[model samples]
Target: MAQLRYIYSMPVERIVRYFNDNGFHVNKATANGLLSKTADMFENLYTALGRAVLEDNYISCDETYYKVMDRTGNPDALNINKEYIWAMFAMNLNLAYYFYENGSSRGDVIHKKLEKYKGTVQSNGYAPYKSLRGEILRVSCFQHCKRKFLDLQGNPDADKIIELINRLYQQEHKHCIGADEWTQEDNLKWRRKYSKDIMKALKVALKRIISSPEYPPKSQMYTAANYMLGEWKGLENIFSSGIYKLDTNTIERLNRYISLSRRNSLFFVSHRGAERGAIFYSLACSCRLGGINSFEYLSDVINKAASLPPDTSLEKYRNLLPDKWSKK
Candidate 1:
């Protein structure tokens, strides 16, 4: 099942065929039954990963949509419902948590997921983040801001803004010696000396673009300039702290597998199935983030969780986490 889901990402039909070809005569029904039963074990790993992600002083979050079979009958509803799969991971730590939200209410769901979190959350400039401004430090992704202007390439004002942002990135690239080699204090010093000046220039460029006659109200340039101006504080937050990242590109890269799985399998049969998939994906990502072997990590986690009492507390479960268990 782990091989089919995590390694190959094989659908049920393909999984059954692979087993049958290997001399095991398991059919699709049998394969699915086994898969469903493993949800409990997957939940154990997912819950542990979630706790670790929330405990971090910093995390990056993003969500993608997936189709689910709908049981509800709203007047405006179609045969299927669009559900959101949120990926939130610790920025400095090797942990990722995937969550399934069956509705479109981003504000409430984000608040619930990050209820007690007091650290900065770096995300693409989504309006829902406005709700979290007071509760936690809101940070915007420069990559996202740059992408918006990249779409309007012919405009001079847009080109200037992009050039300014490029300079900041160049400064970052110059100092980066990989996280393993670079000291945080040195990194902070470089950013303060160089990146801060470029950001100040970018701010001035943004105001110029907003005031320019070339950027009419409701135009794409106007919208892009407005967004950058509105989220300036968040974008500037990275300069204030060495720990803050320039973008949420790390978590965005992790979402590639989710996209691949969705394209292949189409839609989950049920919400329960979707949640189970989230559990598996979370554990799989946790393994990748921690540099642990997925097969070994999943096998050990399932085995250890099964050996314990069903009523075990989160503390006991934490010991079995990949980062913790790997040391043992």
Candidate 2:
């Protein structure tokens, strides 16, 4: 069962063929059955997760594009567009998890983050979150804001704009890094300066794009310019509040784990199958964070959870963890 986790893909018959040709006796049905059984174990883990966590947990969400072939047997099936699926990861103190194939919009992800959330909410500046219209504490990521400018670093006109954006970022970052004993007037002064510079840069960049024939038709300039133009208020909103940040680095890091599974095989035949893969990925990510041996922990978790009283299994599992939980 543990060895199966490392196997990305192979038909059961191929493994059986290898064994048979090598004088081993593993049969076709048995190999297929074994695969199904291990898959079921992950499905069980998914069921266990839903009943495990309490309300004090954080569930951060984001979405990305997923591709699929149309079933109509067209020759262009490979190039056809499919749905955009969402993957939502719930992060609490003890564990983090993944749930997949839900809504995929800027609105849906933010809506999930805002829904019934009572504690601090950490995320990127994805517009729909702004309409959340609540007092929930939002901590955006500086890494996210900095990266937008970073993306435009090599851009000709955008290089100047990146510097301007960085200056705005740094002005607020200075306060975060203990630069101020600042007052309302000081903040307003900085904001007005940032807004004016942002407006000026946008005007210049737009004019340059309009007049320049040398610009690439689909280029970083438009991406950078449009973002600054559309998100100027949110970018400037950083200085107004002492708490709000410029991006959502936490979610970005979280994204790497859940998303890697998507990239590995490029597709899952069903959301349920993806759900099982997500459990393993979530566990792998959590184990990485805690500096535990993921395979050993998973083996221990699966082996032990199988024997514990079903009523107290999750509790028993929690107690067995090396981090602040009790003995097995």
Instruction: Give the best candidate by TM-score.
Output: 1
Candidate 2 segments exceeding 4 Å error? 1-60, 65-94, 102-114, 127-130, 133-135, 142-151, 154-157, 164-246, 257-263, 313-328
- Per-model lDDT: 0.79, 0.52
Q: lDDT of model 2 at residue 163? A: 68
Per-residue lDDT of model 2, residues 1-328, tens digit only: 3233322333345567777898888887686466456556555455554344324344444455544434345555454343454444444544445555432455765566456656544455566655665555544444554465576667667566666556656665554323467764666566666556664665676567645776564665655455545554555454454444455555556566434534554554444444455555555555655666766776676666566554664544455443432225
lDDT of 1 by residue, 1-328 (tens): 7656754567778777888899999987787788777777657656877988888878898988777776665545555667888889887777888888673546788878787888888888777776684558888898888989999988788899889888887878876646668877888888899976787788888888889897797899989989988888888788887667888888988888778777777777777778878888887877787888888877777777778877888888877776777633
The regions of model 1 sitting more than 4 angstroms off are 73-78, 133-135, 177-182
Best by lDDT: 1
Q: Find the 10 residues in a row with the least total lDDT in model 2.
A: 1-10
Error of 2 at 130 (Å): 4.1
Quality of model 1 by C-alpha lDDT: 0.79
Candidates in order, TM-scores: namely: 0.92, 0.58
